[model samples]
Target: MARLTALAGGLAVALVLLAAPAMAHNHPSGITDLVTPAVVRVEATAHVDITLLDHIGELVHVERSYDVPIGSGTGIVINPEGGIVTLTRVVKTDRDVAVYAANRVFAEHHKVKIPADFARHKLKDDVLNHHLQECYPPKTPTATCIINVTTNITVFPNVSPADPKGLKADLVKAGDTLDSPAVLTLSGRVLGSLGMPTAPLADKVPDAAGSPTNVAGFLGRPAPNLPFTVDIAHLRQGGGGDSQGRQFADPEKKVDEPVKLGKLIDEGFLGAPVIGDKDGHVVGMLFGGGQDGRMIGVREITAALAKAGVAPRRGAIDSAFEAALTRYHTKYYTEAASGFQRVLELYPGNVVAAGLLKISLQKRGTAEDAGTKGAVSPTPRSLPLWPFIVAAAVLLVAALVGAFLLWRRRAPEERVEEPPAPVATASPQQPFDEGANPTVVVRRSQPFQVVPRQQPLMTANEQPSVKYCTECGMRLGPAHRFCGYCGHPIET
Candidate 1:
């Protein structure tokens, strides 16, 4: 019976254990879903070349180029303006610039030619007139018709010169020579000339903490124009002052330790952007260095461009771009590609968006030019409580049924009774019972007596008797307390 009861109890425990995992799976936390859309891969066409220097400190321009295959990083699209703020270093290096658009079209640096016309004026002089001695066609001997070609001519033939459009033109003129600018094409409008600059964090538009940010870039070498997503774990406060007045963290810090952006998005995302998900505004650009990811703030981007005399205006490419990004996060890759293409159609220089759009298209198992369905706002996944409640109810019913069955089975067992044992009487003994019930024969125990042994005292001529403990050879007192050596009591 005991074995049967133990078996039933074990079976009941096993049933409860089997149902726990199902309950937990139905109710996942909300944080898991929130981060899916905010992550992105950053792609950079890294034109890496090594410049060897001569002993005299002059640049020994090695007549060779080390154009490393295109690199990648993660970045965020902060605002609706087509301005995709990423690390300046990513697009600012001494390499040719190319931004892949959503339509799978790589927008490269196309040298444009503008027609220019100039007029040159000059004077022509006739030194001496030669005499026509023979006289050709019937004319007076003194009369002479002189034909002369003037030295003034307006040269208006088609003249086209390749000149960088924006701030770069200002820097590389006759008087001042400046670095080439990073440029992006948005909706056929040139967005920038020099690379984006870094500014102070306090100067940027306020962004709340815990706001969702996305990053897109490259990890290693990606196939030509492939795009991917990067995971952004978190962001923290970081900045420092130096001897060069107030130097903000951006391109300069990239060569040093990996900064905050580097910590979150490391080597692969050398120049990705940290963008605010709320409005798709680029908040920070990634820099590769430091244990943690490093990035420069958006304010720095605006300030740097401003210093170069380039005013960045918000474009219409942001909404569609974000919509596509949202689709990609939701695993709606097909729709995402379409959204990215739409953004590219409006803004050409959005490299990050263009790269991702192409990837989203590829993920959907479709070609880059394939049509996709329109996207609607997704319904948030709700906590599933009914399944857990039903499971609990079933468990409670099973336990109650088990208890009822057990009680019923125990009720059928019969009770048993046992008879009590009889007491025995003792026989009486006959003695002087005739007189007074015979004074019961009494018996008494005798007291024990011990014999004492006596020892003779030593005379003056003989040595006094001395007692010693057998255990440790210590002397004992005549009245003998306990032996000091082994704590044995001595007889008096």
Candidate 2:
């Protein structure tokens, strides 16, 4: 009983020890909870000029259109006017920029003229046709429509200015130093852009000082989206040069170190938000393909946007924008376009959703045209079923034949062959008289018998038992009353 009790106690202790680590590992951190809401997928469609260097030392420039998609990157809603504060690199464009708000609302160019006949046809199908008819004109046989046209595109959120409490505005009448970072508010919540509270190096930094930092970004072409991230070892102050200056000056150099983001958040976290450890504020964006992983600070992001003469704006259309984005991800382009259009109706200045909406509308239009064409097309004739039936019949006949042949080959040999009868020899010739019946004499063979020959009788002084049987010279049984073969009796 004592041994059993000790064994049970040990097992209980072991189980408790095993469960402790799992509970700790599964506990969600403050950073993950805080930044998940602000994370948004930035989807862009742009024409990238590809330059190829051939073996012959000739450079070929190819202008190809590509859809760029960035998923689950950290972003901030700066204001109620639908302005979003995200990494400029996240929305950078050689040709165009489109934003997919957290609510899935799309901001894109919507000023295209819609033909009367096309609009009427689309409206006949559904109210959602407005999105398609407005952006893509039906192609006429006489005049081919150019589907891919290079347009200067910009996107912004439609944030209403009336929300007093959420609105954050820097009150600079005419001449203010504007030394500190600007703060904006939306829905009465004060918002800060990437550059707001810059991260500074702490004291007592080690000689070989570098801390793990997460970088997230979108990879591959946008049509089929691929998102990924990398962890980088952020160096101390003046260790690997300033994070701000080094990133822009040498984007290639930062791609050379292996990033260790601890075991908890490692691979498959591409395009994940990287938040500040102190306040859980988003401070950087990550891109894949760097040895240590590529990351750009908030300062660099804001600076890039300033260069492009654009600022982050979040507005009333944000909810609708996010909804459209969700629809797009779900592959409901029709619904997505409607959602994007609702956003546009609310905020006409949102270029991100406007551009994406144009593409979505075009896709929807083409799909409708294809569907109509398929409906009008003739049904093809199917081949006769007789061929299959005939083949099956032939196979059945062949199987029957094979079975019969197999049975014939395996038949018993005794059943197939019979032995010949023996011929009889003529008896002694006794047929001299032809008239009288001939009588033939036959000799019978002697029966097999054991006859005992006479043997000398033993005297009283001698043994009475016989040494062996006289007929067959065989030994007698131990307690035999008579010989087994000839009936000769023997004394015990």
Candidate 3:
């Protein structure tokens, strides 16, 4: 059953946000404050001013009138424009007896015989019935023959009779006469109204643990089961006066339920708001039926408002807060956080929003850090990274250059002079004989390019030229001491 108790709204937020161990017991959130302004203790005073009439239904001289308190009843404002819902009897002054009283006085004023009516009326004057009728006609009737007509209804709101906020409500459509839901509206009216909750409470199955399982997946996020329970209670009093019939309770529902109102509400508290405990939403209204009372659900209240041609709408803060609360239950921590922040912006210092926001932030932080304990922390925004990166790059380039220069510095310094070109040992004075034998031409055995060894102060072309080995037909390298391939002793 949706029978929930009324709690402070802040407490409800805390209950949803706090951990299980930290919140050992349910705390008061004072959520009713949200509904307090909407809820009103209605003290209605109905007055009737009587005048006499003649036998022909013509008005006669005025008779003694009455201006007295009829009764009190509570009512819910369905619209910020003054649309309210209450018992039909509260707003409707059943002056049927007053009608009879006026007629009796008319009979006596005309000096006509009194019919067999249950009540008698005092005579207005000694005028005869027909004479008074002749003297006072419809519009042309004399002032003395005017019909008795006067009724005043005054509604006192949250304040008592002494409070200045007393508002006079007008009867738009009396349920007693229309057989529809009873409704009312105050003079000053209400500035805002609570929007009805559209979603029904789906029956939840509990997991192996006793808590309900959150089977609904909320946009790829883990849905947390709402750990809060609905609180229910009724405001009741015992006294005398015309009592407004209370709303009917669920016939099959058992009494003693926290939400089921078993006691009779005195007439004064009839229309007072029946606030929910946890969310402070109106679970139902305290309506008078008989000895038992029932709260009107959001659906019924909505319907009644519709019938009255008034739409039940939500204010800015209430709308955002409710949306956030819904997201919180589904464990949409990020979205809920944004929603709560929006509400806070709209209504600063909103306790419910603040508490819920803290919860949302905490949950979001935990979700983000779930497995990132060893991960790197984010860099501070105050420092720019580009400068540091550039510095590192410069250091790397300098290190490479330093290594290259150090190798050059460690290179050999002493140069061995080539020994005097080994004497060709007169390739045998045979050369002199060969010269006479034929015009012989000397050519290089191995093709070679001239290579030069240069000091730091010299250029490649300015270095000393290398000579080839005269004995083994091989090219020489810088400072070579022997022929590497031929195993011959090098001259230089």
Candidate 4:
């Protein structure tokens, strides 16, 4: 029974041991941790020649537009090729693209305009189409606005921004295009000029991730970090709860998904990439602010860029990372931990993976303690010493408890009884002739008498016979009629 108990206890302990490793697995990125790195702050400064009053109140023309900052908004890198997608309102000629990639800020980038189709709203007889050209900047040449234009829709990705790879794109096909309302449509160029009708957007293909069904085919796939959702206030410090930065402000026209948000950002965040909380996938490029803010979805953005002769792809690292993310979402912590470790190995600078791995390790202990979870992997070749120690402790406790109960059960039998008090009696006869009063005496108890096993003595309580001698308390044989000690008389 003792052996069986030990065996059962060890088995239970082993099961308990399995839970620690699982608990140690990595944690998935939460809403805040995932999105912080990918987000970028875009600052565009432009000079517009303006007519202004001089210090003496005389009319004067200023060549530099330094005082007026051209455009301020947000943008996110959409493709590995360095294609940055933002609201078109932020980009203009003479505008400088300053990007804040986390802490590493890049001062200047070539501004490129995304390809979009705009429908110009015009009245009869060619009156001023004031309503249709809202996207066009004030400096856009009037001669180029010969054609009426209205709505603008994102149909393709701008394959080029200032190339982070330091490669300049070769010129492609050039022609006039009325597609964009912001452009001088009649001349197929900005300000009625002829050349590439759009800003140089296509330079090279973005690194494409293989199809979701066939992830293994891709080579050197880039792993996008998991994304998060945070309150607009959390991103900035010391703005009122209700008030936010203009860049993060809600747009006047809110449209549809791909860019749908729980709450609108200030104006600065308008063009920021809306990343998914799950896989860190770019859901859309944010724009618009009506009832529903609009975003260009990943598929549509990439697909349009594909039509526009730009390659769009996801990297292998992204695939692996996303698989790990799936495991984490399903609570397969052990696998997720391994996955996150792999990501860190691939890219040590990946903060999201590191954070997640730390969380996984911390949760593993808790899960193991709860007994509801255990490790998924096989046991290691060498067991940890802790398990053995735990088992030994458990067994020791069991032994101690058993000993205590056994002692309690045998206590009565082991107890010693006081022998009956001795009666007064005359001394052996030393003082009988000296006028001695009856001498009193106390006798010590005799040693316990033992009958050998071979002798086969019956217990006094078991036998009905009065076998003990009443006189002098001597042992008596069953057939004896006389006391053996003190010569006391006895009846058979």
List runs of model 4 lying over 4 Å from the truth. 1-39, 47-68, 93-263, 273-283, 290-292, 297-300, 368-492
Q: What is the lDDT for 68 in model 1?
A: 34
Candidate 1 lDDT over residue span 1-492, tens digit each:
444555555665665556444333231222222221222333333332222222224323322222333333432322222223344343333322211110011001111121111111111222111212111112344422212111110101000121123111111111011111122222233233322211112234323333345555545333343334444433333343111111123333333223444544555565454545444445555554555554456666555555544455433443455456566655567777778787656645455555577678566743322233332322243234455556656665666677777878875453222222222232232111122111111122324332232443434665545686676565553434455334555554
By summed lDDT, which 10 consecutive residues of candidate 4 come out lowest?
A: 211-220
In Å, residue 203's CA in model 1 sits off its true spot by 8.3
How well is each residue in 156-239 modelled by candidate 3, as lDDT tens digits?
333211234455666665553422356665555432243211111111211121111111101110112311112344322221
C-alpha lDDT values of all predictions: 0.37, 0.36, 0.44, 0.36
Best by lDDT: 3
What are the per-residue Cα lDDT tens digits for candidate 2 across 1-492? 344445545555555555444223122222222233233333223432221111123333222233333221233443343234443333332322221110011011222233322113233334234333332323333211123423221221112221122223211111111111222222223332221111111122223334333333223221222322333345333333324222211234454343443221223233234554443345554434333444444564455445434455434445666667555544346776888898667655344566668767776634332223333321232233444445555555565666667667865532423222222232243112221211122222445544443333334665544466566555553233344544445444
Best by TM-score: 3
- Could you give the candidate ranking by TM-score, starting with the highest? 3, 4, 1, 2
lDDT of 4 by residue, 209-287 (tens): 2111000000111223312223321111122211121112222233332133323433344555544433434444454
Model 3 gets an lDDT of 0.44
Better of 1 and 2 by lDDT: 1
Supply the global lDDT for candidate 1: 0.37
Clashes of each: 59, 55, 29, 48
